[model samples]
Target: MRDAPLEFVTAMAAHGDVTRHDADGEPVYMLHRPDLARHVLKENGAAYTKDRTPDDDMLRPLLGNGLLTSNGAEWAAQRRMCAPAFRPAEVDRFDRVIVEAAEHLVAHWDGGRPVRVDHDLTSLTLTVIVKAMLGTDIGVAGEGFGRAVDAVNRFIGHYVPSDDPDPADTAARYAGFHRARTFLDRVTRVIIAARRAGGAGDDLLGAMLAEGHTMSDADLRDQVLTIIMAGHETTAKSLTWTLYLLDRNPEAARAVHAEIDEVLEGRSPTAADLPRLRRCRQAVQEAMRLYPPVWLISRRGTADDVLDGYDVPAGSLVCVSPWVLHRDPRYWAEPDAYRPERFDPDRAARLLSHQYLPFGGGPRICVGRHFALVEATLVLAVILRGLRMELVAGFPVEPEALVTLRPRHGLMMIPRPR
Candidate 1:
């Protein structure tokens, strides 16, 4: 019973699985055991669904039964319709879009001044996702969307069940959520309308429309909103975290640059160069293990189940946190160290299933995994080729547990000319 909240949860994880009584006094199981987490996420995945808490409801207005939050038949249908859009070939098609965005970001960097790396990464990814997914220019809409995301992150970070009603606070939270949703809704609707008007061309939205599914305005908005939010935030954090790690680990950063230099020789990275950027990909993978974006994944059991000798009732809230599992000593050697060699193809090939769940597992695993990896790798290569970053003195980087793991204070760093 510590006074702090998230620290208590993090400490509880070091031991075996811990169950806490929620606001309703119902037991919510937090599985810190890596093997058990693997069992539930991969081996026994069929027993769980993603609708674990009111968080889904909070996002429902904007996502509107989209694949990310939808369960059962709706999830299946959305997955089927959008699966092709994220296929390896389709994701490769967005390489130029990602490279272009990276170049645009690099062009704005001032080597003379300290820059907030977090903001730059977010803006870059948002621009790339908007162009690649919808074939639309959301440059004007990005500022509002970024603010809304900040508001949403703040809301999720400080979330606690209310024991007594405070009307002003409640109204403000709801207002913030709605404002964020409205911003995304406007962008999504415009993209959908443009696609319908034959402007999407060869982008993902165009492919979705060509599939012959007559989605209503609301449904289309939700799907687009979900993709845009997830597409930008997750990969942006991945790159941000990678940069943080690189600043501290110069040798690892050098290895990555060497790989890129040998592979591309200063040309922009294309899909074919992705495989050649092995060290860069490993660096990103290791960074994710150290600072995963989607740190905690929650689910609710649809039926009673026993996982690793613990009884989980039909309505139990089950959380399998990658933040804990990725660093489990039983699975990783030198768990706290930043070592990209762990993900080397030869090494990773021998790992047990579910040992590394950066993108999750099972049927409901993130459909955007390929997309995120491509975007992260390309951005990493592009940045390293042009500039070098060093951690700023006296600027503390602390992980803030929100819907994703972001820096509490902005990630400030100094960019020196390479």
Candidate 2:
């Protein structure tokens, strides 16, 4: 359990559907079965709560009481208030912002050079999320926000056990996190202030302000950071992996491009165009199946109960890793292969609700799920129109399980003119 933090997801596969680990003296259950995963995350959700372990404590300071970390009435309130902004209808209205950000990324790309696809997409998604959610540009932010996120995640990646970390090392990590949070805090405060001064508009932040929703200074900062970082990192990594997979399979790439050409017709796409881009959506779905950004989720059992007829003791931590479940032979045929057609409308509709959880399930499902799909689909359509990205030969794609599933050293790829 302690030795292979990066391989935790894959290592669990060597065990059967359910395996138990001794955390201190207590037993923690890692359930790979989709049915039990659904039971824990959705069906009998009340029987469990977010595991309030030290790992989560590490994020509380950075995230505060935002929706991602908060529980009970607090989480409910924040989720309800923000839900309006992330709904499909609302996300559709932000099409212009999404396209504009994609355009901005193209302008900055060093054409025909080997670009760090992961870092580039991080910048692109960060820009899109900021503009859509806050109605602001990240101009000259110089990829600082993404760097800050990486710094904190790298610190957290030291998921290794310690009787106590070296005092100096602890201090360094805390200091580093402080610097990153300070930057995000400053950015969030500016957004809040700008919204206040300018009256109000339809941006998510402005809409909240317009509705007279209020929070303490700290809570607002947390919400701002949560909205931006959560939306930014997941969508970026999904795009990076999608491109990586497409590069490895030219047939699929050609199909994706043909669909893009047919549906978009050499014009910039809109929210209306998204519904007709079936192949584009299928590719994104299959990509998510292969490398879901939020790869692992866990909840501590609140009561002694039976899940799928197995005893789940009260207070035991139960993990549901989508990484394993998506690859489970039980739910998928040729799970490891990149087969976008597996998600064609008829087949996708036939999949069991519990089996496909790229965005998670049940009440506390990701708030930005709709926004992410819309954003990812649009980014792929626009980017493929002008460039064909290929992985540099021999570039290692190491899957690092951080706050999101990231390619450890960043995905290096070359963008050739289409």
Candidate 3:
């Protein structure tokens, strides 16, 4: 499972829509059917809890009881408090940051040489999230900030579900994780302290630390770290995969290029322009369908429950995988193909709830769903308008099923002006 986790889970789809196996005495159920996914993630979601589950166990060390790992009333309160910051008005405010950052990265690209799209996008999205969320320039935190995040991701990539206790952490990996955690903790503390001293903030951080808010410094740290990490990492992976997919499919790439040319002419994209960037947006959507950033969603049953006629014992671990569901031949036509048109507005509208959950579903759906789509679409537009990335030949790109689905060795591409 550790050597090839994605492959191991994907192989189960061959058996049936629902598969069960034992891991250290616990029954692990993998749901491949959308209806079943809905049962676990939505309709009967109350029966499952993220708290203390495999996902929370792995992420709690880093995220604490942030919205992603919290449960019940605690999760509800956090979600409500954070909702105002992600409203339409607030997300629109982030467009300029996304485009400007993408444009900045484009300016640095060497058109003639191979560029690491994954690495550059990671840095770009990190910068955007920091500036947009906390109103601070990540640059001030130095290069180690990005390195620390990378180290954390590397350590997390080693995670595998087991009923037994986690194996002893490797010395080098644990050291890297510690440094990353410490650096992020210190940075968030400084930002929060400065903001508190400066009085009210108009950004996400300020709102969370506003007057009368019950969030202590530690609580703020968890929420801030969760946003900074969740906000940037997934979007970066989505863009990287979008570019890689477009590069692999010439017809799709041309469609995106033509759409961008017609829509923007020579100007940069804004939030208003998002509605018309159809093909570019669809490309991003399809890429996520093929390689969802959050490939696995883990929860444990809080009580005995029945799903799809199967008796789910209390304490059973249930997993809903977008990776497996997205490619189900039962729902998607030519499931393995890079066909962005699959996400054409009308066609996409026909998709059932869990059939295409790049951002998940139900009450606990990703709070930043709109923000992520807007950011990815606009960033893709900004890039396609000024440059085209050509995937290096035989680069051997493979998806590493870590905390996010990432190109295992980084995507090497040549940036050519469009």
Candidate 4:
């Protein structure tokens, strides 16, 4: 499971929609059917808690008790506090930030050389989140924050829970983790201090800061870090995979380019144009279906329950994986193929509940879903209209199932100006 998580999960899904396995003497239940997902993520979501899950164990060290790690009333309050800023109208105001960031990346690309676009997109997204949500330019802090996240991702990428571990390797990994954590902590404090002095604005960070009387500086820091990690990292990987999939399927690429050409007509897209950029939207949606950024959603059952006739005992590790669910033949046609039309608005609306959850389902659905889709669509339009990325031959692309599913080797591609 540690070395090849995708294969392991895929094999498990093949056995049955609901399968039970033993992991170090603990029960791990995998649910693949859509109704089962609905049952676990929605109907009985209260009975399941993120506490003690792998995600909680790995991220709580860095994310603290932010939305991702908190439970019960705390989580609800954080969600309510953070909700206003991500409302569709509020997110629409960030469109300029998203477009400008993408335009900056397009202007910087050297058409003559191969670029590691995955890395570049990561930086671009960091800039967007910092400027749009945090209410400040990334400036000097952006580079260090990017490095810190990369180091943290590297550490988490190789992490596997264990009773006994190698002392030397564990020490090395924790050394880097602590270094990253320290840098993140320092930068977060500086941002909070600077933002507080200026008074809170209307962005996500500002929204949180507006309620500062109720939250400690440490609490604010945790939420800020959570937004940074959840906001930027996941969107960056989604864009990277969207481009990779387009490169893999020329027909889809041509369709996307045609739609962009028709929709923009040589002008940069605005938030208003989002609804009209159907193909661009569909392509991103399809790409996520194939390689969701948050591939696995894990929780621990707080009480015993029967899901689809399978008994899930309290203290068991329950899994709802988009990676497995998206490909289930029960919900998708040609599940292995890259077909963007599967998300054509009419067809998309008909998809069964919980069958296509790139942003997840239930009350815990990503608060930034609208923000991410708008950013992804506009940025994708910008890239497809301005340049063409060709995968460098023999550059092996495999999904590394870490905290986020990322291309194992950074996506190496040659850019040709459109």
Candidate 5:
């Protein structure tokens, strides 16, 4: 199980478009083929739901019935209520906050010292998310929050096992998971309570309070916790992998820095600058293709369905692995190579539709997609503007599959003055 699951999935993908595996004698289908994924994600999405028992059971206590783990009417209601907050205008409002956080992060980096890029990116992204979404001083809350997140990941890693659960292990896992959740919940509740007492003071949380969409304290708690847990780690992991790829491929890194230099010059990046940061965005896209933090998106069929000549019974578990599909030779050329140019507009147009599932697809696609792109591009621009990085000698950056894909060993790199 220590072996990277993406590697196994990619190898299997080379043999067939889709493959089936048995987990604890329960049949599960892995959809690595792009067309098949599209069929399930796009065409037949409504017939399926994001309701998987093991995942839901594991995450439910932490996320509650929030959008990431909720299903049916509950999901629809929350999605409708929360969708406005991620609109173009609202997301654009986050630009300055994101840049400010990035600037603060850059100010603290010791350029001459070897640093764990993954840890740095995670800290930076978490700060941005907290400021932009919650309007909280996460720099103050960051240490405890980071520890809780790490504990949650460690708990999930141990808990997601195939063997029949041991009572002791089960009890320990529950304790760890709930402890993390309780810590996050305390942070979330304090914010919510402040908002209720009219102290939110002109931020997303304040806006959410004004809307009054979440009437129940339980609902608000779940939504706030969901965003904090779901948004921060995924975006951080994406940036970590992007930097890792760039460090190994200097040519691509050079192109990215050049694009940033030419496009934004000394000015901080904004939503308007996103179009000019096309190369930067492409590099991040390619990185996500290679290492999508949400590598495998699992769903369950609500009814019997036939997909690409395979019968999928109702209640069947279907996993669509972007890590495999993104590297399929049928859709990509030299799939293993780091080539951001493939995503250039003219070149990208030639690729098959639905070939890329970096953020999944269809109605259930990531709502924070635009927000993430803007944040990552802005942060990348800020980081490149003042610093250059080199991979640390002989540091093995292996992939660790957890709730998200992270470096098995932290990403250590040498940063130098630009």
Candidate 6:
């Protein structure tokens, strides 16, 4: 388990690209080869589905059969129906909302004081997505609501079904998942019904209704919960990592601010301005490369599959660590360094296909990838340009692979006025 980050990386490096081992009797293939990754994620994708039982077991209770966890026909159909909601123009509509959320964070900050970045960015991303993706304002709404979701994410992230636990304790966590999920379900249902009746339908819920494709309440719950949780969580962690990286590397922060100065000239960045904010984009990309928000992408081989002479039996578990691949010493120099320039023009050009799995690969790649990039770009533009975030000295910020590659102890920093 990469939950033990050091052991996981050392193991991956030991085998170079592909390694197969028995895990409590069943075969587990840890693949690092780029072409092989394409085989599993792109070319021979049908042989696999995102149904690795161990992780999805915890997710099923929260996500239902949403796009993130569904397989086969259900997955394909839902992908089509939800495509329009994330189309360029639809996501473009949320530009102002992203900026507003970024600015709102800056406004609340007192400057030069230690800030709990994980909490702040989570609140900002949650608030933005709830408004922009769902057409509802859950602005800094409930500290408890955010805290509850964190508890569920923690339980799911570190949970290993194989490890037997006390039945009483397991039941309590299950109860917690339902408690948080029920609240989210109510919120999603409200948006769904309102949109159906021609009410507050400005986000994806609106777009779905406008298309006349109705989903049963159960399906709707799954979709909304999937979008809200999956949609906001990854981007939030990515943003947190980006800021933390920039804060510690003043040179990278200078380059980021320089790009903002040259491009936006002291104004909030818009979609059109994104292309020119090269350094900002690189900083974010590099951060994701170093600490991908969703650290592990796993699937189950539905049919016997072979890659590079290695046989992967049907029902076997396959895993790809963007965290591992991005840092593979074979491909990346100084695999552990935080240098945003690694993503710059000359360097990015030399990168290979599956060498970067920040958003995963191929057809089943995250549908929200574009929207996430846009939101992250805009938020980075606003904050990285105007603020200087310094990590609280002596605070150890390390990756704790959970539902996301969250900072082990929430990223603590001081966001001083630039």
Instruction: Return the top candidate by lDDT.
Output: 4
After superposing all C-alphas onto the true structure, candidate 6 shows an RMSD in angstroms of 2.2
Q: Per-prediction TM-score, please?
A: 0.93, 0.95, 0.96, 0.97, 0.93, 0.93
Write down the lDDT of every candidate, Cα atoms only. Answer: 0.80, 0.82, 0.86, 0.89, 0.79, 0.80
Tens digits of lDDT, candidate 4, 24-107: 788899998898889888999999999999889778989999998999999999999888878899888888889988998888
- Candidate 2 lDDT over residue span 26-68, tens digit each: 8878887877888888889988877485436556768877878
What's the residue-level lDDT of 285 in candidate 5?
83
What does the lDDT read for residue 313 in candidate 3?
91
What is the clash count for each candidate, in the order shown? 0, 0, 0, 0, 0, 0
Alpha-carbon RMSD to native, per candidate? 2.3, 1.9, 2.1, 1.3, 2.3, 2.2
Q: Which residue pairs clash in candidate 2?
A: none
What is the Cα-based TM-score of model 6? 0.93
Error of 5 at 325 (Å): 0.3
Name the candidate, 1 or 3, with the larger lDDT value.
3
Model 5, 146-191: lDDT tens per residue? 8788878867654345553577877787798788878888988987
Lowest lDDT 10-residue stretch of candidate 6: 136-145
- Show model 2 residue runs off by greater than 4 Å: 51-55, 164-171, 211-214
Which stretches in model 6 have alpha-carbon errors above 4 Å? 2-6, 140-142, 161-172, 197-202, 210-214
Q: What is the lDDT of residue 182 in candidate 6?
A: 74
